[model samples]
Target: MSEPLKSEIAREAEALGFDVVRFTSADAADGAGAALHAFLAEGRHGDMGWLAATADRREAPLALWPEARSVILLGLNYGPDGDPLSILGERSRGAISVYAQRADYHDVFKAKLKTLARLVQTLAEAEVKVFVDTAPVMEKPLAAKAGVGWQGKHTNLVSRDFGSWLFIGSIFTTAELPADAPEEDHCGGCSRCLDICPTRAFTAPYRIDARRCISYLTIEHKGHIAPEFREAMGNRIFGCDDCLAVCPWNKFAHAARKTTLSVREETNNPPLAELLSLDDAAFRARFRGTPVKRTGRDRFMRNVLIAAGNSGDVTLMPQIEGLLDDASPLVRAMAVWALSRLAPQRLRALRPFLAPAEADPAVRGEWLEAAA
Candidate 1:
């Protein structure tokens, strides 16, 4: 009875454009709770307090929704057409993570998941709910357990077929569906992913500290960026893809279909000078419908200013200089650092005029630190 239901769900998932689909019981992902506790205990999750707040729900599907009997995990291929790391050499241009270059994956995958969930409900007469990244879903471990892919050393889901580029989502249903065997980890002794990190976010093979991760710093971090990470950040304005890009498994991956995620040409490696000019409205208008916009103008500009600081292009000096008076202290702090990097003499020349008037202590600290 459930075999037919699982088959129908699989067919519907494919029809809805999900590249891969698998099923698993909604039981606790074995030992995932312990790992979650350990990660939080060690403060590896950084500023993402939601992870700690929803530990029970994140530990298992049933914990999230007790009615959930089986989970339908899906992976959508979002592999980029070229090398994601090549942008690092273009210091004048900002590097956005390949997954973020287009439409928000959360929106794209959630729409397809809802479409697929309806089929599960109709076929088995069961209650169902769909989830993308927004929830506290342990998608990586759950996907790995469902044979969607294995969590590689970098602590991300890795697929032999789709490589590291799969955008994973899941559907939980009350119906009991057939479950797939868990995928085996094939990253034996392959240290490429861990070795390639710019900030060495990985403390060990599978353990990561988000505090040091550029992706976390540029996107999730809400305060003044730590001074130590600034120079290593390069032009990664939104998120870092270094670990994902270096995965050897990505060679077999295929680019995501345009219908699933259309690449926004304007955001693809936009000039640091141009990005520094965005005010609140322009930033929202430019990154609308994309994950980048969710970071908001202040944080996004902070990342851009870091990129400008690393750009070494004197032409960006004026744009960087203007941000010294930005409304957001986060923006102004980085602007001071950027000025110090791009044009120290100019920063020194303007210091007597600007330093005394600075109100925010963090911004004042940046001025003192840079002037030192």
Candidate 2:
């Protein structure tokens, strides 16, 4: 593709609501493989075994698609209009990550990516493949290589123009477009992202242990949350944004211009009591178009129960009480934990009746541990 065509593509992407666009060679992502291997070797990825399963393919764009000669990295800003941490103080309400407060970004970005890909194909007569977060592509490193942003200390791509709030997408094509100069790391002396982690998920600057990440635990892990991190999880029901919210770079960020990525009022700070009452159908209806739906009713309720336990609001006892008999053992177990924290006396009183009826060993243990 000609340099003029690349400029036109950038103009077209900007018109499509993408905040940043740049190009890099497929080999620009070659250095990311070693770090990924090291992360998996130490099991830092935790229960996200797919990261291990797809490590080889994720290491290089060429491995993903040999036909790809150039990688076009696109970024869409989803900056929050207000302080994301303010919701954390509202302990009775759950704090969803700002990015998840809207429609699923994959759906939104994929459509835009497809449109841009079609434009590129017609202009360059090149074969194109587009990817959002779903694909096993190292978008952050590729974006950094493409001059979109540097990978911040939090390991998220942080742009000088968009701060820490950019959602990345990529288009790999057989066209050999001119690659942009790589962006330099600007996170020289800041450690706010590292220190602000609720679960201390970051082991060091730019390195995170996913097992301890609240986002990973709440959204990706399928089973019961570990007791050690429950108190630290706070009221974050969907995903944690402590590290991202604390970044000073966000000051330069503008509120998301895309209506599809804007925060929904219903999801902003939903009351814990209301979330606890959601059944499968109601949960689906409430989070139908959002990323939270991927967690399913059981896992989401389990997270809500954890928040309820941390709330210390004895008034939520009735809601917690009802979940004790929930069909999901994960919910029942967390309900016991929440009940124990909020109403230990009631838990003590109901133990004999509840204990004998509980068949799940984990649920029985929660009752025993709470009573003890």
Top lDDT model: 2
At residue 121, candidate 2 shows an lDDT of: 97
lDDT of 2 at 189: 97
Error (Å) of candidate 2 at residue 260 is 1.5
lDDT of 2 by residue, 123-187 (tens): 88999999998799989999999999898988988888878898999999999899999999998
Candidate 2 steric clashes: 0
Give candidate 2's root-mean-square deviation (CA, Å).
0.9
* Over 4 Å off, model 1: none
Steric clashes per prediction: 0, 0
Which residue pairs in candidate 1 collide? Answer: none
Cα lDDT of all candidates, in order? 0.90, 0.91
What lDDT tens digits, residue by residue, belong to model 1 across residues 1-372?
A: 368778888888888788899999999778888999999999999999999999878888888999888988998888888888999999999999888888898988888888888878888899999899889889999999999889999999999999999888989899989899999999998999899898889999999999999999999999989999999999999999888888888888888775658678877989887888899989999999898999999999999999999989999998888889888999999999999998988999999999899999999999998889
Candidate 2's C-alpha runs over 4 A off are 28-30
